[model samples]
Target: MAKVRLSAAAWGLSAVAAGTLVVGCSVSVNTGHAKPKILKDKLGDTVATRLAATTGQPKPDVTCPEDLVGEAGTTTRCTLTTGDGSTLGVTVTVTSVDGDNVNFHIKADETATPAAN
Candidate 1:
């Protein structure tokens, strides 16, 4: 049998190298257009459908620009046409842009009031 040995220093270096490599390989989703995509996604599917059905609002008209982008702590405006022929403004704010994952906050625009069915 062959035996191999590594020094403490060597093991420490290897550990550090592995950690660095992992950190480097970690990826994050870009805020570019991610903001809009998230908004549209939630709205076009669950959020809009639920809101419209419950609120007696017309099918929501989700409007988001393909070019809108943002960074953590940044916000962008989005709009949806409501049932009452009124625009329901919303803000898509980026909370985190981390490794293939993005965290955000979506809410009605500060000046807009949400209508309850």
Candidate 2:
């Protein structure tokens, strides 16, 4: 009887540990940090083409790196620039993304200011 109880306790502890591990590693869909493959499949080609054309830069440099952060339902980045005269090096936060369209809010850094009209 004692041995059976001990085995049951061990099984229970193992189950709890497994559950905790699974929960801890679970990914949140809203976290903007979805799997890279998924993001690439969904927005990869389109984003690359658009950014390349808009920035007039080569294909390699226009790629989005992993570890891009998504905050408040948008991805944010700093020091991103296009090859063209128009620069987006300021601290820019994406507010929303719909299909190929992305809405962003830009907070200009002192070093990179907007041109006067």
Candidate 3:
């Protein structure tokens, strides 16, 4: 996991960009077949990449508990851990699906949670 330091205001601004960030993931899906999903690592990497681009910061550490289901309205929670050990909650929601492409929205929490002692 990579960690990047960020000011509170920078986090806030990133949060705003997060709200409107839509990432499209390409994966093959067959109707009436097994369910499709974005793997945990892939999801985390995508989020980190987008966040880094938005904030002009190094790619931060992000972890997802489970794979994100590739279905409209499906969602999963991922965490972004900063260099100082603070964390921000990120919600990834599937907004729409088209053929083999999955489009989702990423929204970060308005504030960070201080590290636990």
TM-score of each: 0.43, 0.26, 0.77
Leading candidate by TM-score: 3
After superposing candidate 2 on the true structure, give the runs of residues whose Cα lies further than 4 Å from its correct spot: 1-75, 80-89, 112-117
The predicted structure with the larger lDDT, 2 or 3, is: 3
Clash counts for the predictions, in order: 5, 0, 0
Better of 1 and 3 by lDDT: 3
> Where does model 1 exceed 4 Å of error?
1-59, 66-70, 110-117
Report how far residue 110 has shifted in candidate 1, in Å: 5.9
State the lDDT of candidate 1 residue by residue for 1-117, as single tens digits: 632333324323432343333222312333345333344454334333433443343445556543224357666655655444345454555666665355555454323334444
Error of 3 at 106 (Å): 0.3
**Residue 80 Cα positional deviation in candidate 1, in Å, after optimal superposition:** 1.5
> Which ranges in model 3 have alpha carbons more than 4 Å from their true place?
1-4, 7-13, 20-34
Per-residue C-alpha lDDT of model 2 across residues 12-116, encoded as one tens digit per residue: 343233333322221222334332222422233333333334333332112334433334354533332323322333233445444433443433222332323
lDDT of 1: 0.43
CA lDDT of 61 in candidate 3?
84
Judge candidate 2 at residue 14 and give its lDDT: 32
